[model samples]
Target: MIDAEITFRKLEIFLCYMQEETISRAANQLGISSVSVHRALHSLEEGMRCPLFTHKGRNLVPLPQAHRLAEHATEVLSKMHQGIDETRQIAGIGQGRVRIGTLYSLTLDTVPKLLMGLKLRRSELEVDLTMGSNSDLLHQLEHQKLHAILISVTDSDVDQHQYEVLPLFEDDIFLAAPKLSTLSDRHSVDLRSLKNEHFVSLNEGFATYHGFQEAFKIAGFAPKIVTRVNDIFSMVNLVQAGVGYTLLPGRLIHAYRDSIRILSLSSDYQMRQTIALVYAHNQQLDPNLLALVAEGRMYARRRSEKR
Candidate 1:
C-alpha cells in the first residue's frame, strides 16, 4: 500500500523539480521557497522508502527510480484533473456552456467586447446571453439561473459574501433628451429644475431606475411620469421621439450622439454607476467562469487606458 504521507502536492513539487532539474528553479515555478521544495522532495522519497535523488557536487540529480516515478506522477496528476472536471460536470457546476446575464444597456459595447474576448480565449465554449434589469439579473444570479452576470454594482444590493465581484468600469449618469429639444443647449441639467417636466423611466428593477429615483428624491419632488419601459433602448427611443426626458449612463452617449442629447447632471443630482462582473463565490474556480473573469479584467484595463 502507498504511504499516507504521499500527497498530490508533493507529487506536483517532485514533477516540477524533475523537469527543472534544480530546487531553486522548481521553487520559482511553484512560487515556494527552495527550502520548502527540498523538504518536500526529501519527504516524498522517505514516503516511497527509496532513494529518488542522488547528490552530485551541490546539485540533487534524479535517479532512474525518480524518472519512473515522474512518469507515474504525471499520469496520476493528469487523471486527477480529469476526474475533477468530470465530477464538476456531473454535478452541474462546470458545464462546457456558460450562461451569461447582462443589463440591456451593456449590449451596446461593453458586453459585446467582453464576449468577443471570452470567445477568443475559449473557442470551444458555448455562450448564452440574457439581458434584463439590474434587479432582475441579480435575482437570476442568486437563484443560480445564470452562471454569471454583468450589471451595475452601484445602488444594486449585491452581497459580497455570496458573490465574487470584478468591477469593470464607472459610468456617470446623464440627462437625455431629443437633439432639438429646448434643453439641448444646456451644459448640464439640474433635476430640481425639471420637477414639473414629463419624463420617461425604466421600471423599478433597473439600476438606472434606482438612479432616477435617487436623483429625483434629492430634488425633493417627483416629476410627472409619461411612460415606463423595461429596457434602456426603448427609453432612448422615447426620448428621441420627444416623448420625455430620461437619465442614462455615459456609455450610451456615442451611440445616440446624432439623434439624442446627453447632458451632464448637476452636482446635486450627479450619480455614477459601477459596472461589474459577478458570479457565485463557489464558482470562482470553474474554468469557464475563470476565463470570463480574465476577459472582464482585460476589458476593464483597456477601458481605463482609453480614459
Candidate 2:
C-alpha cells in the first residue's frame, strides 16, 4: 500500500518539473541540482506506483497519470499554505490571544465598546483584561505579562524605544466638583485659580497624577491636595461627596456623567492627556491581538466622527 503521508517537498518537486518540462530548468527554478530533482521525481513516482512523465527528446511530456496528480498536487499545496497561515495566525505567531492591560477609566467606556465589536467579529478569540495604574500596566506589558496596554501617556517617564506606542485618543483634564461647591461658579475652572482649594487625585504611581502635577507646575502653582484615591471611580465619588475637587480625564466624565459635573480648564492651565495603545517591540503577532488592534482603530474612528 502506498504511504498516504507523502512529503510535501516531493510533491513540490513534481509540480516544478511538470511546469518547467525539463529537470534542469526545474532544478534551476528550485535552486537545486538537476540530479537532485531527478531523484525526487523518481521517489515521488515510486511512492504513487504510477508514471508521472515521458521524455520527448529535450522536453518532458505529462502522461495521463501525471495530469491527474498535478491537479491534486496544486490543490494540496494551496490547502497546505492556507492551513499553515491559519495555524500561525491562531498561535500568536500570526494571530492568537491578546492579553491586555488598561486603566479603570477606560474600562467603563472605550475598552468595553471595542471588546464588544471584537467579540462580534471573532467569536473564538480570547482576551485577558487586567486593570491597574498606568505605571503598573506599563511594567506588566514590558515584562511580557500582558501583550499590550492602553494607558495615559505622561512626560516624566517616557520610554519610546521599549514600546511601540500608538496614540488612540486625547482628552482634556476636567475638574469634577459638587454642584453646590464654592468653586462651581461656572462650567469651567482654571488650575491656578483653584490653587488654594483642596484637591483629590489618584494615588502615587499613576500617570494621571503625575500629569496633573506637571499641569500645576506649568500653571505656576502647587495644589493643596486633601486626599488621594486609587482609581477614577473613587476620585469621582470623593468629588461627589464634596470631599474635594479632582482632576479627571474627560473620558471618565463622559462615562460617569451623572456622578459629577465636568468643568473645563482655563486656557493658561489646560491639560490634555493622551491615551495610547502600547506593545513591546518584539511582541509576537496573534489573531486576538490583531482583532484588538482592529477594534481599537474602529473605536477611535467612531469617537472622532462623534466629535
Candidate 3:
C-alpha cells in the first residue's frame, strides 16, 4: 500500500540523486535548486519509510535498498514515456500528424519535397519534423520517440537487420573550398595533395564524419582539422569564411555554390551517401506513415531514373 504523498517527482529525484551521487549535481541535472532536491529526496525517503542513502561528506552513497528501487524506477519512467508517445500518436492520427525525424542537411531540400508530395496524397496529413545528426535520430526512433527517420547510410555501420531501411536517394561527397581557390579551379586534384590543408569537419555522430575518416585514411595522411561543427550549415559557414575546407554532399552543392566551390576528387577519394527512411519493424503503421513511405519510394524511383 502506497500513500498519496508519494509521487513520480519524488521517484525521479531519487533516481537523479542516486545516479549523480551528490545533491548539487542532481539539482543541476534536474534543473532545480539544491534545496528543492534535498526536500524531494528527504520526502521520498520519508514516504518509503527507509533510508536510501548515507551522507559521506559531500557525496551520498546509495544503500542496497536504493539499488533495488532504481531498477523499478527506470522501468516506470520508460513506460511513462512510452505511454505519452502512444497517447500523442492516437491524438495526432485523426488530425493527420506524423512524427518524422530527419538529418539537418535534408531539411534544406529533400524534406520539403517529401512533405509536399505527402500533402498531395493526403491533404490533411501534417508532418512533425525532428532534425538531428544520424545517430541521434536513430536512437529516438528506437525508443519510440519518433515514428520514422531519414538518415544517410553512407557508413557501412547502419544495422540493416535492426531497422527497416527504404533507400531514398544517393549523394556524393566533394571537397568544398572558398570560391576562386586553387583546388576549386583545378580540373581535378588528388586527395593526398590536400593532406596538409586545414579542414573543417562534422563531428563523429554523422555519417559524413566517418566518410571523411575513411577518405583521409585512403589518402595516407591525417588532416589538420581546424575545428568540428555539429551542424552542416555551420561547417559550410566556416568554409565560407576561409577558415578551412570540408567535404559536403552533392545535394547541398547548389545552395553554397556561390560562396564555395566544390572540387572533384580523384576516384579513390569519392564517397557516396545513401539517404534512406528507417524505422523499427515492430512499429505500428499509421495511415500517414504508410502514405509518406509510399511517396518516398516513388520519389526515389524518379530520382534514380533521372540519374
Choose the strongest candidate by TM-score: 1
lDDT of 2 by residue, 1-307 (tens): 6465357998998898888888899999999999998888878877887777777885668899998998999999999999988875553454446678999888878788978998987887678899999889878876677888999885555577766776788888767777667666465576767767888889877877877887788878778888887887888888888788777788776666676667777776677888878776655355666677777888888878888
Question: After best superposition, candidate 3 residue 180: deviation in angstroms?
Answer: 3.8
The C-alpha stretches of model 1 lying farther than 4 A from their native spots are 1-4, 11-41, 45-83, 91-94
lDDT on C-alpha atoms for all candidate structures: 0.90, 0.79, 0.84
Question: Could you give candidate 3's per-residue lDDT for residues 66-96 as a string of tens digits?
Answer: 9999999989988997887788566554246
Model 3 TM-score is: 0.67
Clashing pairs in 1: none
Q: Residue 183 CA error for candidate 1 (Å)? A: 1.8
Q: Clash number for every model?
A: 0, 5, 0
